[model samples]
Target: MIREEVKIISKEYLNKDVLKIRFEKPKEFQYKPGQFINIKFEQEGSFRMRAYSILNTPSEETLDICLKIIPNGLASESFKEAKENDKYTIIGPFGYFQLNENEKEHVFISTGTGVVPFINIIKEFVKKDYKMTLIAGYKKQENIICHEELKKIEQENKNFVYKPTITREEWGGLKGRVQKHLPENLSKKMFYICGLKEFVIETKESLLEKGVNEKYIKVERYN
Candidate 1:
């Protein structure tokens, strides 16, 4: 890991609670698509930090982080008020939640803001011949994030499929949690899951019960 102070290039709200921040990439800094960075700042004379997954592919010139704001959250509150040119110390290129380059058939499951890393992975690695299925879960239609971009990817790449489901509100698309929308067959496919702890646990268990080898499943959990 390396420590560097970077300037925020811009900030925008992607949804009601999700903020997308772009930072100036430091010279000589490099990171894989699915990694994350820890942003550190000072509050009340004490240092505070939070880790957010990198949302931009390595081919992008800048670094992007998608943050889900929470009520009274220290880091979230601070980031909500952050402005362009603001400088913060970041340390990382952390986490092993990356893609297997050789895998042709891949399945990704994410809930809410947990979809960040998958966005990076797909944009960076998905190719014309690669078959990828993305199953995203949200509480309501308004809670869905990055749907437009995912849809564009699906439209442009015939091999890619996007499935978004809502749990609390009715929609024309599928309803219920992502686990319920998972594909029935798991053979010869790799699965990547990210979401709340319970969602990850339940999905992993369901996959295991369906005879998916643990080796073919990769998971990252959020609180």
Candidate 2:
């Protein structure tokens, strides 16, 4: 629980609604991959704090986060006006969503910006001798975030495979929800899931029904 005000070094939109913001890393800040930090800001003239998952490995030079701007949400409204050099208080590198070391193969499943933590986790273990697969779901191609960067990582890393599924739109690749497109070797790999309640609950139930041990499946629910 260290809290410090940090300067935003850069901020840009990865897509129409996703904001990629980078902060000058505080010398005292320490965190593991897949963790999130709370940003303290003003909402309705009062102070409000919200948790955002880190998108880059902690070892990286800067602390980066991708914000999915929900329309009219308190935190979303504050971030919409955010600019470079803005300073905001950040607290903790919280959550226990780090990579599972016991499994040689790891599967990351998510919808929308739920993929944020996986981005950080993957960056940390990308160099290790482990197989990683990402199943990311979105409403349409236009809604896909970090699509090209994940693809490039897949192309360059023999251990990684990126699968993007689109629902409510025409797509030549995987379609429908993430639960429908899970891998075959379910019992062997560690599964990580993040998303809204319905998606996370359904995906967890689906995995349990498929004989994956409940202990091997970890989930973080968000909206």
Best by lDDT: 2
> lDDT per residue, candidate 2, 124-212, as tens digits?
88889989999999999988988888988998899999999999899788999887789977878999999889999999999998999
In terms of lDDT, the poorest run of 10 residues in model 1 is: 123-132
Query: How does model 1 fare in lDDT?
Result: 0.89
Candidate 1: regions farther than 4 A off: none
Instruction: Tell me which residue pairs clash in candidate 1.
Output: none
| lDDT values for all models | 0.89, 0.90
Model 1 clash tally, residue pairs? 0
What's the TM-score of each model vs. the native?
0.96, 0.97
In terms of TM-score, how similar is model 1 to the real structure?
0.96
Q: Give the TM-score of candidate 2.
A: 0.97
